[model samples]
Target chain A: MIQVKNVTKKYGNFKAVDDISFEVKDGEVVGFLGPNGAGKSTTMNMITGYIDPTQGQIIVNGVDVGKRPRKAKKQIGYMPESVPLYEELTVKEFVRYMAELKLVKHKDLKEETNKLIEEVGLKEVENKLIRNLSRGYKQRVSLAGALIGNPDVIILDEPTVGLDPKQITEIRDLIKKLGKNHTVILSSHILSEVSQICEKVVIINKGKIVAIDTPSNLEEKTKSKNTILVTVEDPNNKMESIKDKLKEADEIKLVKDNKDGTKQYAIVSDTNVDLRKKLFDILPKEQIIIFELKKDESTLEDAFISLIDDSKETLKDNSQTTVEEQEEKNLEKNNKTKESKNKQKEKNKKGSKKEDKK
Target chain B: MWAVLKKELKSYFLSPIGYICIGIFLLIFSIFFYLTAIQSASIDLGNLYYNTAMYGLMLIIPILTMRLFAEERKNGTEQLLLTSPRSVTGIVLGKFFAATTVVLITLIISLMYFAILMYFGTPNLVPTLIMMFGFLLLSMAAISIGMFASSITENQIVAAVITAAVLILPWFLPNINESLAALDLMNYYSKFPAGLLSATEVVGLVSFAVMFILFTVIVLKRRKAVK
Candidate 1:
């Protein structure tokens, strides 16, 4: 349960997070998706009360982070972007200290510390100092620190960065498990990770929120046309002419040519139109062998890129479409024409004076 | 506050800084022990603690306090500490007491000199204890200054230098202006060596320590905004 209302963070004249507002329901796993330096970490820090927001308010479980930071912070377990940890401390000692900082009861501290150490799979290395641990283990230690007191909300900034694939999967699985009971907010540039693990995705770009939706909804919203990829062996070179038979197909473009003489074509149609049946009936009659046919389903990666690009386009358009900007362009053009005309008149007058002197 | 205090205390011993501070204090105190008490054949332990607090603390205080906040900020561990539910006052006080405890441990070991003095000659126990208490206060005041220096910067070297400058400069202030002698911590220790429990010196040293401790806390609290 988190509510960020019109929160903005400004550094000098630059706004790191610009009027961005989003909420996470209880027990929801929300993914903060953005490119590097897209204000994701800044937003996470504001939510955790690690840094004060330049403007607006962040409420954690009904407590304002700015007003009652301690009470609000008590409900949050934050693993910062850098995975800040006490390198000199042993794994168990670090977890125990975190438990104590979270004010865990002395009676339950040891048991809770051990449970978290095992949960993050650092039991064998529990006694080992954190400085000697590998990066993955260090990350797990940081996570254990966050999870020490079993806080209701867990905020991890780029949880799986720099980890190997296996370690990434392990961490992702751990986060997914965390999502079952706790409200989790994780920021990452990896779209597939967000799509696979998060229930809702908030895409931010250039200090602004581009879009916020479920993973599937974002993917589906970005797909404007139904696109199908068809690979076929066209002995008679009838692939281009097949578009005549499938009238529902809006455009047929060659995508690639295979070494086996089969050509791949992408057939795009208007929404609610199915070109597969018509192509299936027409291709064989036209002396083309159908090899592969499947719809081109867009992934969250495509959705993210399109959303970011669309926001960039809108920003550009906003600057270009203003009436004052149009008027300024017209004035510039008029000034250039007037300057040329004056130059021509001056040249004519100089020529006439030379003629008169001769 | 207790949680932060315990962890900070544990961290002091876990790192080499704790052992190094203690070892260096003892080494200097022993050297002073010989020169001040043993060689002079005097039972006054005041000069022993006096020299230790003067020369030994110049090095020990920086070593103990330079890493208090500088190392945490440098290593990014400040994020973990600041994000927790603990207040800046609690964190600063926890570290303050931890460094003070290390000096306390060294002071306890320095009592062996008092034991030896008791064996060979009669030493005034009241004056010795009074000086030791005054020495603790002086060290606490110096530690608070060092901790304040550490909180303002992320560079340990810079923090150490600032702390050393803060402690070393006040000694030279009285040389420049006789009236500025009150600013000197050693100036406040004048009466304690003679077993006179002057309330002015006690309150003065404590208030000085409190002033710097509060400064450190304010520095940390304000960092939350700019950081």
Candidate 2:
């Protein structure tokens, strides 16, 4: 379990991770979903105690990471991004060393190291120098390093970034296996991977958390309408009149015209309403041929993009309002200054006229 | 800490750096052996060790210590090391002793030169050993400085350059002031060459090693906050 409270990391004036707080429950597979430079790696680094947070407290397994890094770090198994490894070491040696560093008892160190090597599927290449292994194997070696002590929490930063498709699936399965026991927190820009592998998704953008929920919940929350795309052959040109029969449908518009004399129309309705059955029955009675009718489903990818875009739009609106407010103040100040200058000019004219009369 | 020590020692032999450091140290020692010991026709191994410690260590220690931390930082393996539960002092000492072990191996091999001296004529074993002990102490002090230099940079070349400068610049200190000669690492070897184990020399060399080892640990610990 990990609790990050008001954690912020700043480099000079740039806040890499800005006042972000999140928690990973025991045995929860949490996905840190973000675009590039979204502070995912920085957050992971802070959680693992690899880098100190500029301001915050990260508690791991009830121990504050800053105050007792050694005890807190003992609970975390971190595989950093890019699969950093000791190229000079064999896979077995690396894991053994990691086991020892984690303060594993000398008695169990050997058995644990070999078990981890087998778990990560590096048994065949266990004796190969890490430098000679493939990228995917190197990643496994790094994973074995993290899994050496069988820590309660596993933190992986973009674990499947550069792997082949086959390797990606293998690694994802390995992570899912890891999640059954350890609290797994992995960051990735790949939406499908997160959706398939993680139970809870935390979307971060621009050093801020945009949304956090179950993947399906996020998809459902971002679904604004139930859209049904119906392709039909309306020889009688009755498609336009079909709207009159369906009262629940909010809007219907011709989407595409097929050269084969079939037209595709999109019907939109309120969320949670299904218009497919009505359209299926009504079109036949109206002498229209229904070729295709299916509802367009929203996925986690759409949810992710929409959430990130919405946050960015809101940020733009906030800055625009501040600029407009500042402009309004400046205009008011200019008007007051102009009015005072006019009064002073009038006073000077009145003095000149009085002097002329004298 | 033993984990890191074992890996560091293993890596030394696994890579060419270990062989290169030992090869160059022995090469320099052999050259000095012929020039100072055989040419001077003297059985005293003191001058031979003094010259080797002065010149040979400047080359070998940088090669031995430059990659200790610099390579890890560059390859991003420092993330693995720093995130581990091991203390910074432990990692520093692990690397320090590992590099020292390599120097110890080369020094042990240099005993063959002393063996050769015995075949030709009688050599004073006690003074020669005191010189070797002084040589080991001086090398430890220099290696610690090199290790500190490596921790401050990711570039191994820059680390080596900084380490070499640290070792070489002290030799020039006496040119600036007479009192500064006490700070020269080579000055600590003077008592050993005369067959004496002066407390001042031993304590000075040890404290110097301890000071830099402590500095290396501090640099690594501070980097976690700033990195």
Candidate 3:
């Protein structure tokens, strides 16, 4: 078990990780979600005893990382962000060296090395020097290094960043297998991968954790409206009048017109209402043939974006009342304007060709 | 500590640095062997090791120690070593002893000259062994300095140049003031070449090595917070 209590890391005046607290129970797989520069790597470095936290404490298996580093560090197996490995050593040799570094007893060393090498599926390329191997193989070698000595906690930072789709799945499967026996903590920017592998999600933004819960719970919490997407064949444009018939409908937005003489609309209402059942009943009375109708379920990606946006809004609100507030507020406003202007220019360039076709 | 020491020693042999260092030492030994023993017709092997220690070590010590920590820092492999369960003291000693072992190997190979002298004439074995011991002490001191220089920088060339300058500059400093002779590594090594055992010199060289090794450990430990 890992308990991180009020941990904060600061590099000079800038706080990389503000005061944050969380815990990972034994045999649990927790996913750390954040955008870039959100202190994910810093927190992992502190937990692995690679760096000291500026404040608070990290206790792993009853050993405090700062107070008793040697005992605490022995329990952690960390694969740093870029998969640093000894390039001169062969895969098997590197794993053996890591096992030795972790203070594995002489008798159990060989068996432990072999077991970890096989578990990471590095048997074939075990003899090859790490410099000659591909990125995927190098990643496995690093993972094998982290898995040696059978540590209780395994921390992997951005493990799948540069992998291909097939390699990503293989690594994710390996992580899932590891989660069965060891407490696993992995950080990633990929939302779908997190939702698939993580039993709990911790969302961080701007160096502060915004939410921590199950993946489904996070999705449910961020979802504010009951909405349904409906595609219909409306020749005379009777869709706008249908909103008046169903009093439960708060807004109806025409999403897109399909090429097959049909149009799609988004119906939004109160969270307690089931808009799909009401839409299925009311469409036929207006002589509008229903092509397709489905409830719009919020995904993990939506939850991530909404949480980040909410954090930004709260930050803006807080900064508005402080000294030099006008300057800080103008800087953010200008940055947003420049970003949206660039996006508008890109959209205009793409739509120009479509305009010619029209 | 043994694990790191073993791997470092293996790495020295696996690369050409070990062979080159030993080979150069042997070449220098032969030159001194011809000049001091054969030309003078003296059975004193002490002068042979002394001359080589004075002229040959300045160049070879840097080559052996320059890449010890600099290369690791440059390639980011320092992360692997520092994150391990091994303490900083063990890691520093491991690399220190590994580099010292390369010098020991060279000294062992130089015994071929002693073997040749034994075949032709009976030489004083005790003084020759004393000279070898003194040479080991001097090399350990020089290697520790070089290792400390290596730890402070990531560029191998800078580390090499700094080590060379540190070893060579003290020789000229005695010209300005006689007190600076204590800084010359060769001054401490001079007595053993003349069949004299100086307890003070042995203590000086050993303490010099210990001081630098401790400094290296402290620097590395402090880097964790500052880095």
Candidate 4:
């Protein structure tokens, strides 16, 4: 288990990571998701004992990383961002050196080096110097070094950033294989990769965490029920004024114009309104034929973007907060009361369904 | 510590820097041997070690130590060494000993000059051995300073320049003040070439080496916090 408590890394006056706290349970695969310069690498470095946090305590496994760095570091295998390795050493020699650095027993050193080489599929280049290896091979050599002692936690920073699609798949598969046995924390700007591999994702923006939950749950959070996308073929272009007939619909946006005389528009309405049925009833009478229509389903990518934009909006609000702290508090209170009233209405709807069943 | 030492030595030989340092030392040693022995009609090999330690070290020690830490920093391999489950002292000492091994090899190889001197008159064996031992101590002390120079910068050329300036500055300092002669590494070496192994010189050289090694370790440890 890894617990980061109130961690804040300040560089001069800039706070690179601000009071961000999260936990990775034993054997869990967690991802640090953020845009560029989002402090993901900084957090990984702190966990590996490579750098000290300005203020905070990190407990890795059971040892405090700040107090007992070596003890905590021994349990972690860190493949750093740059894939640093001795260019002069052969793959086997490098892995053996890493094993020795990890204080692997003399009896098992030789066997362990060979095992990691074959494990990462570096057996072909075992005798080749790291200088002569390709990027993919070098990445595998770094992974081999990190896996030598079978550390309990393996932290990889941007493992697949500069790889081809084929190499990306290979390395991702390797990480997945390691995830079954080791607690893995990987940071990537690629959203689909995290959604595919990580059990829990910590989305970060501007040094602050925006959300921490399962990827599917984040996708669900951004899924809007009131938005429906429709592909329509309108001869008289009456789709523009269709909102006048459907009073419940709030806005109709022309999303795209197909080259084949069909156009796609998104219909927006209240959260509780089913806008698709109303659009179906009103479009034909207005001389518009609906070709295709479906509800909008946000993927993990949308959730990541929306969450990031949400944080950006809140930061803009925070600038005026110093002058009107009380006004903002009251506004937030009013919003919370409105949210509670909506929740009460939802509960009443569920109760009415139960009565119908009775 | 053993792993780092072995890897450093392996890296040194795998690159040309180790051979280059030894080659430069041997070249300087041979030139001095000709000047102090053959041309002067003398068999005193002690003077050759002294001359080589004085002139050849400024060239050789910087080459050996310039890339010790600087290249690692530039290439990002310092991250590997710093994050390893080892003490900062151990890594510094590992690199220190590795560079010292190259110097030791050059000293051992210089016995060829002694063999040639044996064909002439018998060089006094006690003074010659003491000079060789003193030369090793002086080189170790200089190596620590050179290593410290390497740790302070990431550019290898800058490290080499700083190391050369540090070593060459002390030679000319005594012109300003007589007490400044103490800063000259060779001032403590005035006795070793004479046939006596002075206790003060031995302590001076070892203490200098220990202090600089500690400085290198401290600089590396402090970088983790401030980096």
Model 3 per-residue lDDT tens digits across residues A1-358:
9999998888886788989999999999999999999889888888988888889999999999888888888888889887888787888889998999999999998999888888898999989988899999998888888889988999999889889999999999999999999999999999999999999999888779999999999999999998889999998899989878889889999999899999999999989988777777888888999989999999999999999999989977765676377678789999999999999999998899789899
Using TM-score as the measure, which candidate wins?
A: 1
Backbone clash numbers for all candidates listed: 0, 0, 0, 0
In model 3, the Cα lDDT at residue B109 comes to 85
Candidate 4 positional error at A93, Å: 2.0
* lDDT scores in order: 0.90, 0.92, 0.90, 0.90
| Candidate numbers sorted by TM-score from highest down | 1, 2, 3, 4
TM (chain A) per model: 0.88, 0.85, 0.88, 0.82
Higher-TM-score candidate of 1 and 3:
1
Candidate that beats the other on lDDT, 2 or 4, i.e. the better one: 2
lDDT of 2: 0.92
- Candidate 2 vs candidate 3: which has greater lDDT? 2
Of the two candidates 3 and 4, the one with more favorable TM-score, higher being better, is 3
Chain B, TM-score, each prediction? Answer: 0.97, 0.97, 0.98, 0.98
RMSD of 4: 16.2
Poorest stretch of ten by lDDT in candidate 4 chain A: A318-327
Q: Give the TM-score of candidate 4.
A: 0.89
**What is the Cα-based lDDT of residue B203 in candidate 4?**
96
Candidates 1 onward: DockQ, in order: 0.58, 0.63, 0.43, 0.53
* Higher-ranked by TM-score: 2 or 4: 2
Q: RMSD in angstroms, all models?
A: 9.4, 8.7, 12.7, 16.2
Top model by DockQ, which number?
2
List the candidates' TM-scores in order. 0.92, 0.91, 0.90, 0.89
